[model samples]
Target: MNCKQLQKIENYHEGKLQTEELNFVKKHLESCDECRRYLDELKSQALLLSRIKNFKPTLINPVAFRNEVLDQIQSKRNRYLVVRASRFVNSIIFILTQPITRYSFITAAIVIFGVFIFQQTIIVRKIESLEKRMGSNIVAKESGRPGRKNVDAFFKGRMEVQSDSDEAFRELLGNYRSLQIRYTVLLKMLKEKYPATYQEILKELEEAELLPENINI
Candidate 1:
């Protein structure tokens, strides 16, 4: 039979076709056993579907489900945060308590402090030497004594011709004043650190007439 006649079998079985169409499909089915079998199979499938029990779908609360999922996510995040915080605190404790770490830190601090003290001592000694030279110069200048011939040769020659002697002299005096200030600071530090040594040095300078007796050391 033709496919159109075969397709009309379900409509014919349901009494949904006009009399003329029904007669045509019936005539075709009488000659075509395949179309009759197709119609019988469709009827059997329909009867099986009708016999099955219908069940209502179970409903879900979207808000409740969303809240449950969010709670799980928040719990995971909290656990991660706690673990990270614990590791950070443990690292700090380890650094503070480790013998190697403690020793290294202490050694570095001691070295830095020692270097600072050594530098200060060197500065003080240099200032002390400069003070002695400046005092000798002052004594020579006041006594109208000539300075070293070698040292004066260069300046004396320039002074005789350049007319820059006064400026040069002022520059030299300014430098002497700056050295005096440095010496005073170092002297105060020395006195504070070693008063007996400072007093002995002062008395020696006085006896040698390098430092005036009236000046407080």
Candidate 2:
């Protein structure tokens, strides 16, 4: 077992584990020699610690001690609050102004891309709906059913719909291909220039169990 798992054993043996969890830990300790040893070491430590006598405070001057602590606490609070407030003010200013400057350009780019994607999706949906409607109408007219439109008009509409569907597909393919290229370049630059930060990201991913156990880096 790892250190964290061993720590949990002490928590479990001390009756701190919840009901369902206690049962699982009990069952695990029965079969896991590593965990059993860890629990034994913790038990030994607790036994040794319990035999030691506690020291009583001899200062007796409660007011002086309290005043000193209060002074130190106030100094720390002032430092912490000033730093925190400065950061908070800076972040607020950036939020209010950066969008109109740096982020306006990014927003415009995203909007342009989003408009293309939205158009593609709408066109695709419309094409599907139109195809179904036209197919049903064709079948009805062919099977001796009434309420059929002019054949010339129907053919012209079908051609226009087919052309639009093909154009939408082409546009979507081009847009996604460009997005992938841009993302790949950005990721490559980030990984190369900020390798330590990238490794930290990878470590977080490993802790989340996203990385495989055999992964080297």
Candidate 3:
């Protein structure tokens, strides 16, 4: 028998060969001494291996094992995603915390503040300029305007008129009791139209010892 035909010693011993192949190995083993010994060694080895027990634990919970494997895979995937997110956040923080970036933000804020102050100052200056122009124009118009001699004459006569009014007021105050007695209807109308003012006038008259007891108001 050839090497290929002799190699079927294990198959023949294990009953793995077809009927034709089984007959081929069987006849070859009986005829060839080397292939017969090889077949015998294979049988001895099989018997020894079958007799020995496996020391490792047997897999009884396939479903639990599959879940545990999936859990580990998911946990690793989550860890990878977390690591990627952490790296992205760290990159952003690092960029923002950089001296140039921090200073740029500060400079931008200062420039905006300066622009606002400048705009406010310009507005104030414009308002002040308008006020100054208005004052100057008012002064120039007043300087060019002519004075009224009649108004000056009225002012000059006002002191004399004020003295005469003071004398008249004193006389009227002296006759206030008689005036109240004579104009009883007018006093009631004044009280009705201006209650607070009438009360104040009555209070003043009392303070001056001019109000009479017969004057009800």
Winning candidate number (lDDT): 1
- In candidate 1, what are the lDDT values of residues 93-157, reduced to their tens digit? 99989999999999999999999999888866665554445544543443334345422332222
* Rank list by TM-score: 1, 3, 2
TM-score of each predicted structure versus truth: 0.36, 0.27, 0.32
Model 3: per-residue Cα lDDT over 182-210, one tens digit each = 33443464477557745764565455443
Candidate 3: regions farther than 4 A off: 1-31, 39-59, 114-217
lDDT of 3 at 118: 95
Could you report the Cα RMSD, in angstroms, for every candidate shown?
13.6, 34.8, 19.3
The segments of candidate 2 whose C-alpha lies over 4 angstroms from its true place after superposition are 1-62, 95-113, 116-217
What is the alpha-carbon lDDT for the whole of candidate 3?
0.60
**Model number with the top TM-score:** 1
lDDT of 2 by residue, 55-162 (tens): 454788989999999999999999999999999999988876875766777888899999989976875555445434543443343333323343223333432223
Q: Point out the worst 10-residue segment of candidate 1 by lDDT.
A: 154-163
Tell me the number of clashing residue pairs for each predicted model.
0, 0, 0
* Weakest lDDT window of 10 consecutive positions for candidate 3: 154-163
Give candidate 1 misplaced runs (Cα > 4 Å): 1-78, 143-217
Ordered from best to worst lDDT, the candidate numbers read 1, 3, 2
